[model samples]
Target: MTESKADQPDEKARPRRRQARGERRIQQLLDAAASVFCRAGYTSASTNAIAREAGVSPGTLYQFFPNKEAIAVELGERLNRRMLETHGVVFTLENAALPLRELIDAVLDPMIEFNCANPAFLTLLQSSDAPGHFLEEHAALHDSIQDRIGELIGVRNPDLSPERRTHTANMAFALFKAGLGLILGHEGAEREAYVAELKTALYGYLAPVLGTEGVPAQP
Candidate 1:
């Protein structure tokens, strides 16, 4: 006798449920890896520990990531993409002439928001992945970010020499990364004050590019 829909095996639904289970397993692994890396750093974190943390076997973890470094690299790539997109939104030419305080605040606010929202990203930033490897791993996304920053600079300063523009971009990127590190590494009022100071320092440099007033407290 033919079975009713309720009694019949839902072949399509079974595959969908399996796919979801697979995704959940991978996410659990990533989440556990993030926690492990944050506490142990990538170099010392172990696949076995991560698997244990994820409530999975080392073999199961391997199905998702070949090694610890692979997980760290993937996390870094994801974090970098998130920062680029969010920070891009935060700092814009629309505030092209804002004073140093506002400009710095604008630049840092998004970073603070993103880091606070995703502590794993901050942890990923501490990984010892080789230089340019994350960018290489997420090439198209990173390139799009580079292009956006390039455009922002051009809009902010039509006369900045190409060499200077490149230098400025590199400096800004470095400062943003360092700022997040500083903020995440510290605690209490001290971290908040440091972030403010770092923002001012960055804005002091950016003032020239924006053609806005220089930093109020600087000579």
Candidate 2:
């Protein structure tokens, strides 16, 4: 006797369940990879180590990511996307009017928090052993951010020529990057102090260009 359709196993439902399980497994693998990368550095981190950390067989890890570089690439892409979103939120019309310190805090605080939470991002980007593609991706992300910064500078100082605005934005980005290093390298009170110093430096440099009245409210 043939079984009713409802009595038979639901093939489509099985696939959907499997896919959900697979996605969860992939996320678990990525999390383990992040921990390994942070501890061992990208060059020294092994797929086997990642698998072991993830409580999965090395074969399982290979099925999802063929190699360590692939894992790093995926993780880097995830981080880059998050940073892009943060930049979008911070560089909006609503934020354009904020004082330089508040504006810088809006941009820098979230970034520092993200980096602190994902140390592997810095490890992969900074490590010489990481894939060249990671560096290229990071460069593109940096360019996008700097371009937005230049636009914001223009908004704040409408009288400044485009060339001057671009120059100031580049300089501000340089200082911000340096501050990031300090923030990541220190902990506790030192990190807080570094952040304060960074804000002071940025405000001092930008205030003159932005004028005493600070960033314009509407632009």
User: Model 1 Cα displacement at 110 (Å)?
Assistant: 1.8
Per model, state how many residue pairs clash. Answer: 0, 0
Q: What are the clashing pairs of model 2? A: none
Model 2 lDDT tens row, 1-219: 989988999888999999999999989998999999988888889999999999999999988999998998888888888888888888876666777677778877887788888888888888997888878888999999999998888787789998998899999999988888888898999989998998889889988897545454672
Index of the highest-lDDT prediction: 2
Which RMSD values do the candidates have, in order?
A: 5.3, 2.0
- lDDT of candidate 1 over 37-135, digit per residue (tens): 778876678899999999989999898899887777776676777877885686566544356566567656876877866777655544556325664
Question: Against the unseen true structure, what C-alpha lDDT does each candidate score?
Answer: 0.72, 0.86
Score residue 58 of candidate 2 by CA lDDT. 94
Tell me model 2's lDDT, rounded to 2 decimals.
0.86
The TM-score of predicted model 1 comes to 0.75
